[model samples]
Target: MQPLETRKDYTYGTLEQNQLLENPLEQLSVWLEQASQAGILEPNGMTVCTVRQGRPSSRVVLLRGMDTGLVFYTNYLSRKGTDTATNAFASASFWWAALERQVRVEGQLEKVSSTESDAYFASRPYESQLASAASPQSQAIERPALEQLVMDLRTNYPERVPRPEHWGGYRLVPDYLEFWQGRKARLHDRIVYKFKGGKWKKERLAP
Candidate 1:
């Protein structure tokens, strides 16, 4: 087996402080656009880390919208949703390894307005809407049964599937964000933003 330290090193350019936008959200937008243009698959996807019973759990979810905060959707009864019910704070991390960049977002998540959730939910593909409406997220079930449920729902709702009350959107109102740009010898650049005093306070942290 190869030694962990024997792996090749990352060699990328610097991510200087002055080069960053005052708003971390803006910076994230730029990075996301760059990632998209660079052909990175699922550039909007992020790993959401939530705490349940003092233990951390994480899973990838697609970023559906962004404005005051990062937005994503899921079944409100899922494990992550249950975690949010108990503890609203969570972290979302995005790694565009192809670009040697990573963004860390920590925030308090809240359910978006039902109107907004409904709007987005209404825009999903037909199959996706059926799948979400049929499956019990984060629950164990036999594959055939789950498939049958979706098929049955499809037969029942030949037209548009109404957004299930359990399935909706949550927006992460970020209080903290960190941007990392990998450089040579693992001496990467770390820039952080903290929301304070009704504004953002930008700072640098050790690599």
Candidate 2:
């Protein structure tokens, strides 16, 4: 099949160094709020990339917390978990097309404390809790069998569902972050933050 061609000229806005918050996380918070206010669906959605044995994989996940850094949850034995276990490093990115803005983060990943995972799991909806408990993420299973597993879990735990040991959260401690803003004629703006000397240093990159 022949490939199709398409293009868009971004004329949304410009990004200036003076407009950035001294702290990259603060700047991210501001952009996230704007993305939400702009009516973007799932503004917290991000693409997380992990490497295993020199091969990389990517998937979309919701941003769940920022108390210490960017936090997300998954099965402890999932592909992502396996990758992080061996490599310890990962990257995540967020793109708000409507706002013509993007953010990228590279960092080391570590599992959140079991207590934190338990609290987050407990707060999830009852159905969601059951689903997480039933599904073995990144594993292959027949559709009917998966459904039956969920039904059995639901029947067995009518009131309270205990968080599974394999289900938990991971936090990415960033050493690098970049914010990109699209501009007219494709002359986009790129601002980068690097953690060095126990502080964050900011710089700009050419589009």
Candidate 3:
């Protein structure tokens, strides 16, 4: 058997010639839209990184929604959830190589209201709702036991499954946002927006 060669050309994309966006959020939205148009699977998927005291951890989660802030859902008692409790600060990043774009955001997280959680929960699939109720997120258990628990819950609750009190949404209100575009000769373009004194200041970063 022959060892596989690892090489690819990235000359197909050019970032310098692309028009610069006026605002960072607008730029991110544009790139996100382009990623979706380019058929990148789960374009809204992002990695949420949080620190528990001094230990850093990260997990991939679907972006349920975002505006001025990035929103995601999870069990409040989960590992990431507990980390947020100890340290409210977090960072999230989105990468879509097909579009040669990435966006990174750092901010403090805050819990959304129960009303918001209720609304989102009501919209989830019935199976997902049941699983959410059955699973003790971030807790350890035997695989078979967990599956049996889910099966038992499904059998017991064939109708409406109420949202667990531990489950909810969190919003990361970004104070810093960076947009990166892959460029030629490894000179990537990086534009950062920092919140300062009731206004946003834009700056270029060394790559």
Candidate 4:
């Protein structure tokens, strides 16, 4: 192991309790906005971790929407979906290094209604809609064959593309949420909110 280098000057970016949002969702939104403003690549990208029959798995996915809960779209028959069915509990993380912030959420996953999925699918680009209909996500296939299928799909549906039954959205209802902000001297700011007693309880954690 190499000797650690020391001797560095730093400043603290302390976040006071009053500066934190009372609601974890609201705070998450604020950080997301900041990330967008800072021009982070794929700011809405989040890593979703789920358990499958006692095994852990995770993948990065784009966040589609969030209000009372976080929403993301995927193929209903994909690996993630299979895992979610086996274990509905999941955890998600968002890191925006440019904004020096991160947010972590652990929650229960639920399938969004078909009506909601239909509406969102309708709003997608025609090519994306066609691809979703043609491709069986998370399944292994020959690349050339898959490309040929996509080409055939485009020729078959030159205009509108119908949504696939296997493609839809899932919403996560958070039970615990945490926010972290980088500060000087490694004394970062950390706050956590947990759902309990039918209400949210907030607390601060040492960095």
Q: Pick the candidate with the highest lDDT.
A: 2
Would you list the C-alpha lDDT of every candidate in the order shown? 0.92, 0.93, 0.85, 0.87
Ranking by lDDT: 2, 1, 4, 3
Candidate 1: Cα lDDT at 90: 95
Per-residue CA lDDT of candidate 1, range 44-162, in tens?
99999999889999999999878999999999999999999999999999999888899999999999999998999899899889999999999999999999999999999997899
Winner on TM-score between 1 and 4 is 1
lDDT of 1 at 108: 95
TM-score for candidate 3, please give it: 0.90
lDDT measured at residue 80 in model 1 versus the true structure, 0 to 100? 97
In model 2, what are the clashing residue pairs, if there are any? Answer: none
Give the Å shift of residue 156 in candidate 4.
Answer: 3.1
Q: Write the per-residue lDDT of candidate 4 for residues 5-102, one digit (tens) a residue.
A: 86443342556667888788888888888788889999999999999878888899999999778999999898999898878999999987666778
Model 4 lDDT at residue 39 = 90
Instruction: Provide the clashing-pair count of each candidate structure.
Output: 0, 0, 0, 0
Task: List, residue by residue over 1-207, the lDDT tens digit for candidate 2.
Answer: 755664788888888888898889889989999999999999999999999999999999999988658999899899998999899899999999999999999999999999999999999999999988999889999999999999999899998799999999999999999999999888999999999999999999999
TM-score of each: 0.96, 0.96, 0.90, 0.91
Once fitted onto the true fold, the runs of candidate 1 whose alpha carbons sit more than 4 angstroms away are 1-6
lDDT of 3 at 80: 93
Question: Could you give the candidate ranking by TM-score, starting with the highest?
Answer: 2, 1, 4, 3
Q: In candidate 3, which residue pairs clash?
A: none
